[model samples]
Target: MTASHAPFIAACTELLGASHVLTHDHDTEPFLVDWRKRYRGNACAVLLPADTAEVAAVVGLAHEHGVAIVPQGGNTGLAGGATPDESGAQAVLSLRRLNRIRGIDPHNNTITVEAGVVLAEVQSRAESAQRLFALSLAAEGSCTIGGNLSTNAGGTGVLRYGNTRELCLGLEVVTPQGDIWDGLRGLRKDNTGYDLRDLYIGAEGTLGIITAAVMKLHPAPVARVTALAGLASPHAALDFLAMAQRHAGALLTGFELMSDFSMRLVGRHFPQLRYPFGEPHAQTVLLELSDSESDEHARALFERLMEQAMEEGIVEDAVVAESLAQSQAFWDLREHIPLAQAEEGLNIKHDIAVPISSIGRFIEETDAIIARATPGARMVTFGHLGDGNLHYNVQAPEGVDQKQFLEAFQTPINALVYDQVHAHRGSISAEHGLGQLKVDEAMHYKSAVEVRLMQSIKAALDPENRMNPGKVVRWAQAGTRKENIA
Candidate 1:
């Protein structure tokens, strides 16, 4: 450790316990790397603060020492947002120890929790209260609410509820200046002033560290139904999506589109996960309905929708899960695509969103472009079709070295996909924030005015540029201070 860093570490240890201040490599390794292992960093120590007060104190100490702070939660972020840099100067501030469910107001349909609380735990708590916290994803078991709010995460339930930003009504944040801002008001309408809550929600800790949040909740659905349908093409999937919306209306809670290749990948990796359809179609969709009525009513509605869709030739074939186990099995196929891709090897991943009407053409054109660019490159395509966000990923062809393929095509493929996304009036990042992975690319796509505005906000909030630097937006010129930008 450097002579200058010792005092900072000692002060942190004094504030918390020596055990809470982890300096050993073995104890700090997990916080240094991201979930995908795409980013590996070095930190002098890992600080575990027990509550928001402790967190504020640690921030104050870091500010005093001029030590950069990387606020991390769960470390499941795909964009390397939570990972520290290779520089050993920074300290990782982990929120895992601040996990506490403060309150649950069932009457107001709101739940307040510390940022370190797991997403699934929030769901379970809401269920216990006979309410529902609808922000859900495949990583719910381990991903924390703080990380979700930081990235404004959107999961399957966005079609019915909304993204994490929508689910959250308020936040308590520790600013870079070592001050706490508590905006934890559960009011549905608070048109008080400029919305500081939103500024921190999707800021990815560049502005401040989100400590706790007051999340909106809804009455739990009485019955839930899941169905999988095979379609001839992406165009057909869009048609079926429109029809499902018309039939089920608000009851249609989730709608995910999966390509036949994606299904095959899942089936190849997990042989036991049975494909619901006998024959493979070009595209498949998994649509869900949450009924306030009864299971029979949901089933009848789904059957009617399927019959009409099939009769109109919008759906080639369909199957509705008869039991909860079967429904989970159906979702298992959808959720396992990323896992299967991981098993396959390292690949270029793009979390993109396009206009719902343009998805088919976008995929059709982009897939053809990718094929012509690199033959035998496998595309793993699937996501929330209802929301127009797709996890469009490219894998190395069979018998090819994964590392070599990524090194060869990651750049060009990203450009091609992002170009198409821009052409279709879409976003290169839908749910995942632009961590180190896409921060530069975001600069290229965003207008100068837009980039400047973001820079101004970062300068105003975190002038020192010490909070999770080099992740989101960057200064216009390298090594330039906030004053130079203005």
Candidate 2:
């Protein structure tokens, strides 16, 4: 669109070949739009590099041209982290071409993979070697490992294995200045100064483009059991989780909380899925157990725990999967929440996290607050209860215009939910990074000092603000000068 953008596009094309450079409107359209379709941006072009060297070359070219570069991986991010701004001066660097699993060391319990490798592929590869890649998510089929690491993705397995940041042993990144930081080491313990790998893990691509990563892996569980438990209330669900954790210990892999609304949504949207319980309880907890021991032993242990929980009044009812097929079906119901919600209608979602102990109270109070503020709003809450993260969503009441409700109550509703999270010392963004969606709102809760420190780090790493600008860090010259301001 601009007379000056010709050279920038030309440079990118020269670095990544004409085939790899996507300048046509049709070719770059998908990269410009976000997953939620909430934001649409304009990028001059999209660059697809085949390897780390080519990525470094393309990033170097963009740096020299003084054009912004938005690093994208599968474009599966919930927040618009990969979407460029409206300026049309940026180029989206797609990592899809770099899909490769370089190495899997079973003895070392690590896997080195390219950023573009889909999460499901990584899991499968690990499984093939009798190992387990525990970082699991609903979007694993399409979400790229690079995007997962960039967002520091947390899913059900996070309760046992940890987030992407913890799973990542090292990363190979192309910095804003076009320099490649080859820090891809699989060391179990490295006390080298400054954990630079972490800086880009959840930076949302603002710092650099992750080309590849050395990820941790675990031994495949020989035995596994899945249980669906009915609870009296959110408090009861938490009590069940505490009791289960006390008995199951590290074997308790996943503890998810689902409300009655969530179950109805699933049953309505996914008719194929039969409700495990005959009657709708106040809440449900999908509990998972995994061990290297025998399957029978694992199932017996889970059954015993469930019986004990029922006797203690922690569990209203429970069902332990007798077979692997049954176990997967239970997980299918839990993992399909997003899909089910999508089919139902428009809703405002808050992926908030609170203290484990305060989650029950927070949910009760927040539900009451939401009902009072926005009457007729249907609350659908569920998520990794063990980790204190909840997909607290508010659906527009029946026969109401979704857009109008969103326009009127989005901010207020978010504040209401987030305030409770803040009060409980929880995170507004539990798994998703602060992309364009929450950049401004994050300021309201984060302290001036904390914001300044983040800004300073961004300025220090990406002074020109060419790498995924206008993300995690607020990029104003005045704001960058933290010391001068205060």
Candidate 3:
């Protein structure tokens, strides 16, 4: 340990016990890096705070010492949001120990949970209550509620429900100044004064530490029907989505887009799972219909839509999941694309979004752009088609060095894709919040006034920029003092 951080580490050890404070390189290495392995950082220590009070104490101590904090949960983020910087002065605050579901009120349909609560556990608890916690993602097994809320995550359910911001009613946040804001109101209507709950939700921990949250819940779906349909192109896929929306409407809970290349990669990597389609198709849609009525109703709605789609030539081939196992298998194919891509090689990933109408053009143009620019680069494109978010990723060619391709083309490809995204009035980041990966890009695409407003918010909340520095909005311009405060 460095001589300067000795007392700070000792104070943390004193507060949360010596065992809870990790200073050793081996003990803290995992927490220092992001899930993508794209960013590896260094920290003076990792402090595990067991509860809200403990977290408050940790924040207070860090504030007193003027030390920055990088609040991390599960370490499953892709944008390097949780990882600390190369500077070894910051402290990685681990929130994994505060995994508690405080309450579940069936009448009000709300679930109060600690920040460190795993997303899958919350879903299970909701199911036990005969309700549903709608915020679900691929990382639900390990991703924590705090991280999800911090990122304002949008998963497949976003089509029917909403993002984490809409899922959450209130939050228990510890401000950068170490003061607790117990605004955990379960009320659906609160029009009094400024909405402080929102300020912390998608701030990516740059404003404050979200210790717990009151999340909105919904009545459990009595039935769900899953289907994988083949399409000739993204244009056809858009038409398919439009037709599904017209037929099923709100019951059409999910509509995911998967390129043929993405499905091919999955098939090549994982042979055990049943592939979605046998023949070649340019694009496919993983659509689902859910209802609070009976299974027959959901199946009837899905079948009617599929029949109409086939007649209209929107769907070339389709498979309806007759059983729960079949439905899960269909989802399994969609969920494992990232795993398959990882198994293939280093991938330069882009979490992007465009209007549903423009998605076809977006894909066609970007696909051509990537192919023409980078020869033989494998494009794995898939994501929440209903809500317009796509995980458009790229892999090096058959024999190109993965690292070399990423190093050479990462910048230009990002610019090309993001430029097209902005040109189409789309977002560079839709579901995944702008972490370290796209902060600079955010400043670029975002208007000067908008960026200034955001910077003012961050500076107002955290004057010293001690809270999750360099992830969302970093300190711009000289002097640490807050000038022209909002």
Shift of residue 47 alpha carbon in model 3, Å = 0.6
Q: How would you encode candidate 2's per-residue C-alpha lDDT over 1-486 as one tens digit per residue?
A: 477889978877777789988888999899999999989999888888899998888888887878888999989888898899999988889999999999999999999999999999999999999999999988899999999999999998988988899999999999888899999999988997999998889998998999999999999999888989998899998888888888889999999999988888999989898778888899989989998998887878887898899998888888888788988999988877888989877899998888889988998899899989988899999999998889999999888999899899998888888888889998989998889888876766788778777887888889998989888767765564443223
What C-alpha lDDT does candidate 2 achieve relative to the native structure?
Answer: 0.89
Give lDDT: candidate 1, residue 340. 88
Clashes of each: 0, 0, 0
Cα RMSD (angstroms) for every candidate in the order listed = 2.0, 1.8, 2.4
Question: Candidate 3, which segments miss by more than 4 Å at Cα?
Answer: 477-486
Give the range where candidate 1 is weakest over 10 consecutive residues by summed lDDT.
477-486
Q: Compared with the true structure, what per-residue lDDT tens digits does model 1 show for residues 1-486?
A: 478899999999889999999989889999988898889999988999999999999999999999999999999999999888898888999999889999999999999999999999999999999998999898999999999999999999999888999999999999998999998899899998999999999899999999999999999999999999999999999999899999999999999999999999999999999998889999999999999989999999999999999999999999999899999999999999999898888888999999999999999999999999989999889999999999999999999999999899999999999999999989999999888888888877877777778888888888888898888898543333442223
lDDT of each: 0.92, 0.89, 0.90
Better of 1 and 3 by lDDT: 1
Write down the TM-score of every candidate. Answer: 0.97, 0.97, 0.96
Q: Model 2: clashing residue pairs?
A: none
- Tens digit per residue, CA lDDT, model 3, 1-486: 578888889999999999999998999999998998889999999999999999999999999888999999989987999999998999999999999999999999999999999999999999999999988889999999999999999999999898999999999999988899999999999999999998898888999999999999999999888999999998898888888888888888899999989888888998877775779688878988888899998888888888988998889999999788999989998999999998998988899999888888988899899999998988899999888898989899999999999899999999999999999999998877888988878877877677778878877889888999998765764322232121
Which scores higher on lDDT, 2 or 3? 3
Error of 3 at 270 (Å): 1.1
Show where candidate 1 strays beyond 4 Å: 476-486
Best-performing candidate as measured by lDDT: 1
Better of 1 and 3 by TM-score: 1
